[model samples]
Target chain A: MINRTTTAALAAAVAAAALMSSGANAQTANADKERCYGISMAGKNDCAATGNNSCAGQSKADYDAKAWKYVAKGSCATMEVTLKDGKKRMGTLAPM
Target chain B: MPAQPDGNGLTDLQHRFAHAVLQAPLAVPSGIRHDVRPTRERRFGVYRNNVKASLAAALAARFPVVARLVGDEFFTAMALVFIERHPPHSPVLAEYGAAFANFLEGFDPAADLPYLPDIARLEWSHHVAFHSADASAADIGRLAELPPEALGSVRLGLHPAMAVIASPWPIVSVWATNTHDATPEAPAAGWTGETALVTRPHLDVLVQRLPPGTDRLVAKLAQGIALGAAAEAVSRAHDSFDLATALSTLFGAGAITTLSQGSSS
Candidate 1:
């Protein structure tokens, strides 16, 4: 007993809802990830861990050891690494 | 030519300043003059030096091993030649050295170090892998769950940062020795070619020394070749190709990012 126009509108609404959910899922996935510091190799850092330069590949020393790169959620501690000060510490989600 | 105004309009002034910074030191561009009390030419020289030094530092940052191989003086001179020819096209400095390895191949002074170009290539690859976009590791468990009949037609996608460099020289060893060591030693008399696979699985960018025929496997898989077909191709090329070991290595390195079944032909 539904009219053609009503059926078409319902279909469009369902499609829009699906698209919104997918977009939300993608955002959540991205948010779940974090940048783990003190693990990236020299010239391989994702971006600035030190506030000096606003670019990648700017680490002054090999394993500048304080620089960071992004890793998946809950994977930061597993990347236990040695820092520039010769202290072995696990990577942190927050910039060190 | 008639002497243009000491400062043309804003647009002309900007153009002249840009030229002065990138090209020459004393030849301060015609339409622009420094406001400092020091001679205009001398003040302009400071800007000129900063531009050249920073760009050279960028090159050194991008190719530290290359700079280390050739001493600082030679590396800076060579970097200047490269910077002049291939000025950065983008604001992103990490992407600046795409042409450097090829430039080294034709550089006359570096002719003695024949392997320098390949070494540069390796460094560039490492640079690229460092900044490449992140991707979730492929679900190998799902790959294993596929039916045997469906496995032959499955294509794999590699992580965005993965790259394979096949070189005729012992470039991988040279890179490892120089990059990780303060006092790099020369390679032993007996040196052989190396194939390297660069990837960033977790947060660390790794340079793995790959065995023979493995680079071909990776290259094929990257091109969307089915797993079975890529393996067969490698076997055809190398009689001793080990499929199990290759797959294990790929998974262990977290190189593969996605797996999907290809339509059977």
Candidate 2:
């Protein structure tokens, strides 16, 4: 089950812009100034931490922000969810 | 009511109610489920809270400027109302907010800013096009090999993800003031015409405010007219249509390819 933290909820709203890094997944020059989150698979929408606070979708961003807040405060929980499809087969959200 | 069953897990009725809460804003009355928190604020299930959070986030994503315009609290409430009416059909959350601009138009609360709907649309278009498929400049060498005289006759192809929209309301300007990094200017005085181009070239998605004749020219070309004919059509309407500048721009932006010089059929 997704814990759904409030901090993540807020950050998710803020994470609406420029989620895509450049054409290549390379978080080259623009990394320090801007957050460049990476996705290992474009097909599955998986992303890596670019250290930038901004993520793309509000729900995912909010969830991530809440998780990171704990990291900022030196205490974050390992939040997880098993996504269930029509057959009810579930899978966990891989860590970013 | 008969003894409301406890919810260590969910029953059929509980599942149905939980799904509704998962999808929209609703008063989820409780007697069954409970929260694990020590304070124990039980509004029903985690499902309800998750639904609101996700939907609110979707609204914020779609209308960042609108959220900024109204401030976060007002926008959250607005989004809640929106989510109640329109839960997403597809799992693609990015495409979920398509109806927001229209909803805001009829939304009694936002009646004062009559142009809000159009502005929302412009923003939504930007949002959608921002994530659309965009490819780098194709082998321009193919076109480079074509003869100069043949340039106009060769049917140009637009970039895969380029799109355009024209609004009677000055939406591009409104969106810029609300979202861009440039020096802010007062909103465009009146709802004079405005046109926008949404295209992803290479990696960045660009939403450009087109010049006066640019809309007509792009619109004509979007209808698949050859380059010469589209340019001629715009030049006929506006004497100052600069064929050289426009062609260069569309090509560079990946909005046009294979410059067609052929006669309009």
Candidate 3:
């Protein structure tokens, strides 16, 4: 059961937190920053499609369900994965 | 399709165009035509490719760690499949990818890395926190002034941008490692569950790993539980739980937005 002691303790904790937050705000008050919508494009190839709509032809994805070829050959390759069933496995995608 | 007088023509045309563009092999909408040329297939093909590529690129930007986890080729191919299956519902690109984590759960290629879906979920949460509406911190001085007994009924409101994610995988560590200058590495062998606190107290989004039982505490507070009762409930389950530290963490992150008195539960 909650008692007077618990209530007092929580109030004290929250009060201390307010002081710490004010300190942080003061420090960041002078920092220059701007908020903007939309993220930057990822790479040169993203814009490499040259022609008006023809650039869309430059898209690399085959989009074929049956003849898939890409493999998950990223950082997961370095790590060994432990499965839920206590079986260990390499973090590699099966080649399609 | 010929234009109908009922004004459903535009909507019908847009649906066909969207369907054609999103489809593989460039299925041009039948009625499309270019002013100077007899056929618009080449021009239409460009539209199809741009739509797929740009959307895939947007997905890459939002989920960079996911892209890094699986190399570029794999990510692009997987993203294409995802985009085709789940096209954008809103004009805003940032709102896309809410279904990506679930998609990854069923993706056959990523079956080996079972943790990928959670990582995607983590990244999406961070994205949401970054874009969430901002609000000023609530006046906490009143809490100190309230009578000690009344403190149990005080309900502290958390920031709208704050979210707590409890996961069975070491999502925070994997996300942290790939976020900065460090080269991507394997997660530690003694993999344990992790809970993350995503918040945007000010301008920048922050993702902090929370200690055990803190997630339950935050989740309770988010549900409008009063301070004293929330603490009591959390303590019953988490022997290591400290009320002061949990409150301090929330404050330090600038996550406290409002405070009010409510019937103690």
Candidate 4:
């Protein structure tokens, strides 16, 4: 059951949290960062471009896995992975 | 089979059209005719391509990190198979891909990376939080006004846009490095797990790596557990659980939307 100490602790935590949040708000208020768009890699744009051919699928890849090979070009390629069996190896998107 | 007009002719036509669009595989629907240079077969292929491409684009937007993890070609191929199996039920493209993580779990080609599905789940949570309805944060001043005796029964209403994900993989780190421009060093060796908090407090959505044991406490609170009881339960289970830090994290994220003093007795 909660008693005086627990309640006091709660009060203190809430007060501290409030103070920290206000500071965070102030920091963000002056932040120079703004969201940018349209700079993503080919075919990875956040929204599709609407045009006369808007509904047409422009994707070069299809459902056949044999037609494509893992390129290991993304950031995931650089990461090191420790598998479930305790063996460590460099990460690749290719099927093992 | 070509669908013939029945009492519900429009519905049947729509069904056939959808089936042709998604499931014709390599063949064009026999019902279509083309008078232009492009044959009916070619025109149908274009239409089919457009449907899959646009939907794949939609999934790419939602799961950019996943796209980056595997290259574009593989991601598109995988997405096509997924799209054929799980087309969007709603017109809102944003609502699509709810089952993407589940699909990735059983996806054979990506089976080598066990953490891929968790990453998809993390991305989906971010997408949901980004689109959730906005609500004003609970006024901290009012919380301060409550008497100390009332603290035990404090019930917190979490923001509608808040979600917590606990994964045995370093999902947060992987998501961050892949999504952001400044590539930080990859997650270090011997890393065990990470718990991520996705919240949209105001204009932008925030994804934070939560402290250890904080997710447990937050999960309890999310279930409508009273603050004191939730804290006590988590503390009993996690030796390192800190009530103060947990409360601070929740409040800082504007995750607590309403606070009420329940019956103290």
Q: Which candidate is the best by DockQ?
A: 4
lDDT of 4 by residue, B47-109 (tens): 888999989988876787888788788999999999989987887887999999999999999
Ranking the candidates on DockQ from highest down gives 4, 3, 1, 2
In model 3, how large is the Cα lDDT of residue B30?
Answer: 63
Write candidate 1's Cα lDDT for A39-60 as tens digits: 7676656566566554455665
List residue ranges in candidate 2 displaced over 4 A.
A1-49, A52-96, B1-19, B22-46, B138-148, B181-183, B187-191, B257-264
Per-residue CA lDDT of model 3 for B188-255, tens digit only, reads 64588877778888766667677678788888888899888888889889998877567656665666
Query: Which parts of model 3 have CA positions greater than 4 angstroms off?
Result: A8-96, B1-7, B34-39, B139-147, B185-190
Better of 3 and 4 by TM-score: 4
Name the better of 3 and 4 by lDDT.
4
TM-scores vs. true structure, each candidate = 0.70, 0.61, 0.72, 0.75
Docking class of 2: incorrect
Cα displacement (angstroms), candidate 2, residue B175, comes to: 2.1
Score chain A of each prediction against the true chain A by TM-score and list the results.
0.60, 0.16, 0.28, 0.37
Top of the candidates by TM-score? 4
Q: How displaced is residue B95 in candidate 2, in Å? A: 2.1
Q: Which segments of model 4 are wrong by more than 4 Å?
A: A19-96, B1-7, B26-38, B139-141, B182-184, B188-190
User: Over the full model, what C-alpha lDDT does candidate 2 score relative to the true structure?
Assistant: 0.54
Stretches off by above 4 angstroms in model 1 are: A1-96, B1-9, B34-38, B185-190
lDDT of 4 by residue, A1-96 (tens): 787777787777767766765655422111222222222233322222332122112223221111112222354445453544576555333322
lDDT of 1 by residue, B1-265 (tens): 6665654576687876876677663377775645764688777878877888888998888887888899889999999998877777777876788999999999999999999999999889988987889988764555666655566667889999988899888787787667543466666534888787787876656776666788888989877887766766687899866665556556556688988887633
Interface RMSD for candidate number 2? 21.5
Instruction: Report residue B3 deviation for candidate 2 (angstroms).
Output: 30
Which residue pairs come into collision in candidate 1? none
